[model samples]
Target chain A: MKRTQFSLGFIVRRSMVHRRVRSLAALLALTVSAAVATTLLTLYVSLNRQLHQQFRAFGANIVLTAPDGSTLPSETLATVRAIAGSESRIVPFAYAVAQTADGAPIVVAGTDFNAARAMDSWWQVSRWPNAAAATPGSPVAAMVGTRAQGFLHGDDFPLTYNGHTLALHTEATLRTGAAEDSRIFIPLAAFTAWTGQSASTLEIQAPGSAAQVEDLLHRLRAALPGVQVHAVRQLVESEGRIVDRTRSLMLSSLVLIALTVGICVLATLTASVLERRRDFAIMKALGSTQHQVALLFLLEAALLALAGAAAGYLLGSLCAFGIGAWNFHATIPPLWQAAPAVLLLNLFVALLAAGLPMRILRTMEPATLLRGE
Target chain B: MATILQSAVGSEALIHLHGLTREYASRAGAVRALDQVTLTIERGEWVAVMGPSGSGKSTLVNILGCLDQPTHGSVRIAGTDVHQLSRQELDRFRAETIGFIFQQFHLIPYLTALENILLAQYFHSMTDEDEARRALASVGLGDRATHLPSQLSGGEQQRVCIARALINQPPILLADEPTGNLDAANQEIVQEHLRTLHRAGHTIVMVTHDPEMASLADRTVELHHGRIAAERRADLTAQK
Candidate 1:
């Protein structure tokens, strides 16, 4: 006499329970839609961070130098360092041509060894030669280029620069897929003392968004009027383009998958409703209003949407983590922003499918439908 | 039976119809499913409607049960002009004033037998599990309360249907070919239940092709081509 179950909810649960196969079909479609959406959306946000780090690894994006190959004032290095952000590393390079023992000319560059090594991550070195503690004619540890082995001839060689002969002891062989592979690297202090010259070029690894980097370049150029400042436009432009294109591609793919899943769910729900015409007719014959019958199907659809989206969000988060590991070599956290969109998309699809049957419910005659026709 | 007839609350004509007409659109112009029919049914009366196939018996039942609307007519049931009520009011009126029993039983396949009875109660007002169980026990289905329609035999399913229809204690029962799908023994069982309902003073409107089933009613009306062709009462039979 007291306890009574809310009948609409009861009907929804019983009807869905009875139609497990169809319910699962629709739920599966929704789950996959949410998962794919999550994967793409999570990746979309994280791709920019990952790609920026990758490009920074590839080397410097901004370069500063003097015009006509003239060396800048020694104070200019300090000036440029002050203007550049702390996250950036500015390495100075001084170049000189020294003749080997065989009288062959080889280019040499001197810079902060550690900063250069940190910025040029692609360079492979067997060992970094020690350039400390040396006399005028005494042998000094040198990093020999792989190509200069022919003329430089062994671990020990003699080089003459400005009529002064210096003995070189090779401690490392360097290989870079650039001109650096044919040159030698030494400590900037050592080269400056040996050649009596200051740095003529500065390589700046500015790690930030393209606009931020571009803004930095403009400030550096404006601050140093005599110095030539330019961005490595290839890397900067391509990085921007790649990130934009990747985001666009992910959005496009999510849209396509959502459409496909929506159509599939529509088909599944439509078939489910058609198959249960007898049930609807019986409910109507029992004096159920058209709105009540419609509520049953709508409630079932809403429940399926909620459950599928929740499960899918969890599944999609796992999938996004997997994609981050495989593609970006990083751990990407789930993007919570996609939860509402996924739920709404599934609801829209479910409602579209369920709403079609509501129209059919209005036109149906219980007597004709119950006649087993 | 006469003593039980006094159980009716009042005899102000439980159902009244005038110029009842229903038409359907067909490839060959309008098809009149029911044409110019006039009838009345009193509370506690058992009336059987006999007709051939396509004789509009289902159309009349559909109209009486408020499952469909007549093309041109007035239908007053339980002292309310049903045609004048809104769609929602009609549904409530139907649920409160009439119950349906189909030949196919038309029990929802997924619901248990007791749950089937509870469905009617749920639609009408509230679902009482205790009362639903009692309804099942009254129909000799106490042990079969948990059985789905698919698991129950034809006779058990029909009993579930009767329990479902009468759960709300409606004054009128519209049964269309109630035993058309049952074997002879099951038919007898179902017909005896109808007799008990009739003796209990529940007005019954039954459509059947079997004369034996029709003979159980106090009066029988014959329909032909959507018109009342003949009528017969228990005491005297008339052709017109």
Candidate 2:
């Protein structure tokens, strides 16, 4: 019994030494699925972080807008700002539409640029527009998005707006999420002067994590009457839901693939066990206990599973990472977090798949098993 | 005439089976592979079981080697009742008490002779590479230690199997048709080596259909329909 205690080294050697192909196949199946799971999970977490950062840079946690010409009362504005200040960063902007001298329609935003700068999560600036006056035709400058600048090709010069022609210079472009790509920014004075309107839309940033952003919006509504506000929660919810569905579909596909691999492993192992029945019988006849035979088979399985999992993980990850960078044109995280999980899961799967063959070991009657019936 | 019991207790007798029976159920029907049979093999005694196909010679050898269990009787080897032992205990007993040789040579194809021999020791010890090498040398395969089973001739492959069986220095060796797959010259060469092993005081039990091969052993037992048909002693032949 002591000699037959089933040492780890013995199991490993017997598995690899006796049945190389079946062991390798099983291990490969497990490793591949592990890598897939790891890579997908890592990408999901990282994407959420990236999206949240971009939304934060929009200069407020929440935004409230009213249709044209209904100015918010000064006291209502003061009360709204006060309630938001407890756990949020609040900013007010007057939103309207205007036309360039060439009759191109544009969105006009009038705001306190300094306060907006402090509240926005993601804004890059070469310089903030000056509040001081400029010539009648040439007003204080504004920042425009990359897509908005796309409309003003480099060759187009001395842009005109509102019946007055002024020099439109391209400053550094600030990016928002995909939805915000077409927006343009201008100084409040310039916008109010051109549009001849004096009403405001409120953008509020609630304190705490992104999850709490929604609660802040609800609280803001209860505090302020007749004011409508839009929170980043709307954006986050829709995006998160889409990501969840995608992850579910991807996981289901992986499971199916894993099942196929499991079958391959099972077939290989079962064949291996049948082929070696004589060997097992000989050993048993020579004094190998049933447990020792079982150990030998189990050890063989573990070795195969480990090898297959490692190879599959490496191969799958390489493909996934490559596609994310080249085809999708996105930065994929390094994905080291998935390695251990993949390895463990692969081992488990290999063991599970090897269960059928283990039964073959138990039923092996040494005298008969060796007879080649 | 000496009964099987008296000869079993002599300094030579290492295994004794009493009223042994083995039954098996296959798709065809229930079959009795071994009938009520009493036999004894002395320590260091080289013996052969000879009969036609399906005559239970292989079954008798399997019972002697502990690779099988008799359904109806007791099997005692080295003073231990084999039938009383658990499955794991039986494996340990086999590892410690017996070695086995086969007609096909059963050497793992991918492994070199050295690795193949070392395989037998795996279940018994943690590490014994040098011992395995020494065992291979005992069978005159030291030069061919690194050769795969495919690379070796039939005789050399059988030598590797012999080396593997001898690695543990067990008291009993069971060979099932060790030369059944060998060419005549290789068979003679293997037969010579087995004689040398017997001269060195290792107990060997072989099962074969060849009367010529059976002639080389110290004793021959003939089985027919799962029962002993005849038993002969080499000493008696020498005396005549």
Question: Best candidate, TM-score-wise?
Answer: 1
Off by over 4 Å in 2: A1-24, A43-62, A66-92, A95-185, A192-199, A203-213, A222-227, A230-260, A269-275, A282-296, A319-329, A334-336, B1-13, B125-134, B235-240
Per residue, candidate 1 scores C-alpha lDDT tens digits across A1-373 of: 7455647888778878887887888788778777776777777778888788778788899988888878878898888778886778788898889888778898887787778778887788897655555456666667777886666777888777888776678878888867887887667877777788789999998877778889998999899999999999998888888877877887788778767767878888777777778888888877788789888888888898889889888899899899888877788898899899888987888788888977876686776677655
Candidate 2 lDDT over A1-373, as tens digits, reads: 2233334465457546555565455555455565665556555545545444444554555777664568666676677767666545666677655555456666656676666777763565556555564456643466666566666656233434555554455444556655335555666666666656555777765544445666667776787657776766665565556555755776777667656655665565566666767666655654556777666666666766667657766765676677567744556655676677666776676566456666766665677677776
CA lDDT, candidate 1, residue B177:
92
lDDT score, candidate 1 = 0.83
Q: How do the residues B1-240 of candidate 2 rate in per-residue lDDT, one tens digit apiece?
A: 022224334434488889999888889997888899898888888888888889888888877777667889998887777787776666777777788898877766666788776667775555377777778887778899888888999998998888888888777888999999899988987898889889988899999888889889888888889988888887645321
Q: Lowest-scoring 10 consecutive residues by lDDT in candidate 2 chain A?
A: A1-10
Report, to 2 decimal places, the DockQ of model 1: 0.59
lDDT score, candidate 1, position B205: 96
* TM-score per model over all chains: 0.88, 0.74
